[model samples]
Target: MKKDYNFGYTKVNSKQKTKLVQNVFSSVAPSYDIMNDLMSLGMHRLWKKRFVEIMDIKENDIILDVGSGSGDIAREILKENLLTNLYLLDLNKEMLFEGKNRLKKEKNIKYFIGNAEKLNFKNNFFDKYTISFCLRNVTEYLLSIKEAYRVLKPGGKYCCLEFSTPKSSLISSTYKIYKSKILPFLGEVIAKDKNAYKYLSESIDLFPSQEELRKNLLDCGFTNVETINLFNGIVAIHTGYKL
Candidate 1:
């Protein structure tokens, strides 16, 4: 007999983790966008906007948005009018369905139910790859990075936007209070899933620090790795170029 693996926060069986994650997303899929707006006070939009602007996409570019929930980043990418092919990949079918419904009118986009650690894309297929607030939830962080590198064209860019620990001690302390207390309460009220919200908050704490993530990207064969701390280091955008 094998001892069951328990993921912290959820403490769910290893076999059930995927289903639990899917259920969590499915339950929140309808109100996901609204919850994001509320949780971040509409700042996520700005962060994403800035992320797209920094990419400086060109016409006919192929872009992949992994963990693209509700197609928010995909919509922003389409607004650029530069991307001819936009692929939205997520593990949760419900999230992908919501994104598909939201982006039904956009002919340039496609949705795929896929895992980040094992992408179903050809090697060197994309001009740019981006995952906003998605990397932390991936089952295998380093494998995902390696797969991202493997799928990008030569010199292609891989960008990730995620919550990060604040540098300022005072701000960090204050943020912690909100994350541990208020965030779960808000989730219970809005998304009606306090456990999932708690998991999200805890995941941020477990995620790699900025310096460690930068080194991971470099170790995964990414060149020019850099990080941009946002909103007083509460969030960070990490960028790297595949050589």
Candidate 2:
């Protein structure tokens, strides 16, 4: 039997969830970047900037960036090291095209319309794997993590940046209000799609906690799993390595 997955607050079968998510990204692709800036209050850029820095990209490192929406991470990585080979993958073609257009002048970069749960890459191919602000939206989080593990070369590193649970009660309460109220309001006024943002907000609430995610990486054969919390855990960067 097919398993059910979270489509935000909605429960859906895997296939249903995939199609629904594709539709959502397709609807918002054009305004995705702008909405990201407003939704995170311009902090997402800072997070990605720090994320790429932590990546410590090297010249000629082969990297695969999953769910590479609008190529923000790709842009940052290339800026640090233009010689690195980057492969950007996204389940939604619209989002991939958005990245493609944004990175047209960028060489040594390839784009693929692909699923995270089943990456098209061969085993032990990538020196580094990254996914930012995209994992909670995946239908099968563990499967995708395993896929990230599968594709990385031995000693390769994996990095994931996503919205996370806050450690403080005060920040948690305020963040809840911001996501449930302010996020949808900004989405409606800017992206004209309140429901999509509502779904995104709910997805973050449903995602696993930091410790749980760390255990997941360990179980999937990643060594030295570590997490760096940002904004008191409103967002986090998780890094692991296949050693």
* TM-score of each prediction: 0.94, 0.98
lDDT of each residue in 1-243, candidate 1, tens digit only? 543423435555545765666677888888899989999899999999988877768888899999998888888887776647998999998889989998898887878999998999999999999999988877667889999999999989999998887899999999999889988898999998998788778878877889999999999999988899998889999999988
- CA-only RMSD, every prediction: 2.0, 1.0
- Candidate 2 structure quality by residue, lDDT tens digits, 1-243: 766788988998888988888888999999999999888789999999999988878888999999998999999998785588899999988999999998999889988989999998899999999999889888888999999999999999999999888999999999999999998898899999999989888888999999999999999999989999999999999999998
lDDT against the true structure, per candidate, is 0.86, 0.92
Worst 10 residues of 1 by lDDT: 1-10
Clashes of each: 0, 0
